[model samples]
Target: MILEVAILDVKPDLTEDFESTFKAASKIIASISGYISHDLHRCLETKNRYILLVRWQKLEDHTIGFRQSPEYQEWRSLLHHFYDSFPTVEHYESIILP
Candidate 1:
């Protein structure tokens, strides 16, 4: 499995609206191939900082599978503008667990 984490720093006033839009956006991604699960996390120190944590069977499942789908445009439209800066997305593989 691959884990994709997107760290976003949104404009403060846009937080609530962004969250509302994400709810709708998540549904679109959920329908895509290899989507396992996802959750959104907001920073306690600042509400404008968010991390989108998602799991997929493979990195391509997100990079190619979802992004190539028509639904990607909708997801982009819903959540893209809220970011104060371009989100930093990184992929990781689990190697250890207690």
Candidate 2:
């Protein structure tokens, strides 16, 4: 599995609007192939800050399947405007321990 993480810093005054829009955008992402699950978390220390975590079956599931799909355009339209700056997204794999 792959984990995609992004730190979103929304406009302070538009946090409420951003959250509402995210709710709608969530459906678009969830519909993509290989989308396992996702979560959005708000920061207590910074009200406008948020973290988006998504689980995918593979890296291409997001980079190619989702980002290259039409649904991504809708996702971008619904939520991109709220970001103060473009967020940096990273992918990770779990480390199994003995």
Quote each prediction's TM-score. Answer: 0.95, 0.97
lDDT of 1 by residue, 1-98 (tens): 99999999999999999999899898999999999999999999987999999999999999999988898888888888999999999999999976
Predicted candidate 1, C-alpha RMSD: 1.0
- How many steric overlaps does candidate 1 have? 0
Evaluate residue 83 in candidate 1 and report its C-alpha lDDT on the 0 to 100 scale. 94
The residue ranges of model 1 lying beyond 4 angstroms of the native Cα positions read: none
TM-score of 2: 0.97
Expressed as tens digits, the lDDT of each residue in 1-98 for candidate 2 is: 99999999999999999999899899999999999999999999999999999999999999999999999998998998999999989999999945
The top-ranked prediction according to TM-score is 2
lDDT score at residue 61, model 1, on the 0-100 scale: 98
Off by over 4 Å in 2: none
Worst 10 residues of 1 by lDDT: 71-80
